[model samples]
Target: MKKQRVVAFVPIKLNSQRLPMKNILPLGEYSLSWYIFDSLLKVKDIDDVYVFCSDEEIKKHIPSQVKFLKRDRYLDGDLVKGQEIYQSFIESVDSDIYILSHTTSPFLAANTIEKALSKMLLEDYDSALSVQKKQTFAWFEEKPLNYELNNIPRTQDITPVFIETSGFFMFRKNIFEGYRRRIGFKPFLQEVDDVEAIDIDTKEDYEFAIQVYEQVKQRAYINN
Candidate 1:
């Protein structure tokens, strides 16, 4: 039996309109991207961890032990979609499983990544995306169908639906052999708590993530 090869890829760009140099922004002792990189490194079965960035500052902040892939100008702009970065990583590396993570998710735990990958492998799914369960009455148009004035059920009684975090995505490389995006058929959902799905897109988001991290750390300490 051959060991499964899982490669983690992180796409980071230099220009962020919301928070300038957000990826390298200091969280605690290390930069934001470093936390994500280090978190992936701690995962049990991950074969490699690569940080793909166009900024020289990001490269400097990251340790030498972690792999670094210099992103081209074509893939470095703010307007470029995440799919393009993911595709660039796929074209560069060869692995059975590819894990794409965002540098902004400082609170992403190693255990979550391991569990998601294990579930995907065990169930033989083509992909696994991290999601959070939502129970609110959603609407596509103006009219409400599920919850009417006459029949309004408690929010807790409603069926929960999963929403992708857009922070982490994993898939078999072969499943997207010809495709350019990360999403694919036979995709599995790795449900995560809403608190853990903090994606730092702005200053407020970054501050909120810090608070969440502190709370989690305190809780873990109390439990232990």
Candidate 2:
């Protein structure tokens, strides 16, 4: 049997409506794209990594090992949706599997990615999405989302909610061919750390992520 090939898709755009030029934001010595690019390269199972974006500034952050793909100016606006672009990407790239990641995820850990990849290939899963399983108080309109007002139960007792972390995805290339989506019918929900769930969409989110990234780095250093 032929061995399956795996590649990572890291996409960033020049325009960020909430935080303009957010992708170019500096994180310590490197930019946000540099962090994710280096992390993807750390995954031993991945055959190659690709960076797709519209801005030429991003080229400076990319290493020679990562293949860079250009996006036209027309799709660089806030009006463009991610699903449409990814579907378009699927049409162009050929590989056995794709690991999707975002430049906003500067603190995305290589260990988390390696585990997701290993699980996907070992268990024969068709697709995988990272999730942050959280237990918290929430409401929709006047009704409580996860608990009853009368019960007044502890937060720990409440059933957890699984939130899809757009941080990353692992899927067979065929998933696009079969379902026209990144995930297949039998998709696996891979749980990731709460901090790892952060993806910068707004200015506030970007600022918060920097503090969290520092804490994460400190924790890793102490543990090591």
lDDT of 2 by residue, 102-146 (tens): 887777788888888888878878888889987987777998888
- Runs in model 1 with CA error above 4 Å? 145-150, 218-224
Backbone-clash count (model 2): 0
List all candidate RMSDs to the true structure: 2.2, 2.2
- Provide TM-scores for the models: 0.89, 0.89
Model 2: residues with Cα > 4 Å off, grouped in runs: 140-142, 148-153, 216-224
lDDT, candidate 2, residue 89? Answer: 70
lDDT of 2 at 98: 93
Q: Looking at model 1, which ten-residue stretch has the lowest summed lDDT?
A: 138-147
Q: Which clashing pairs does model 2 show?
A: none
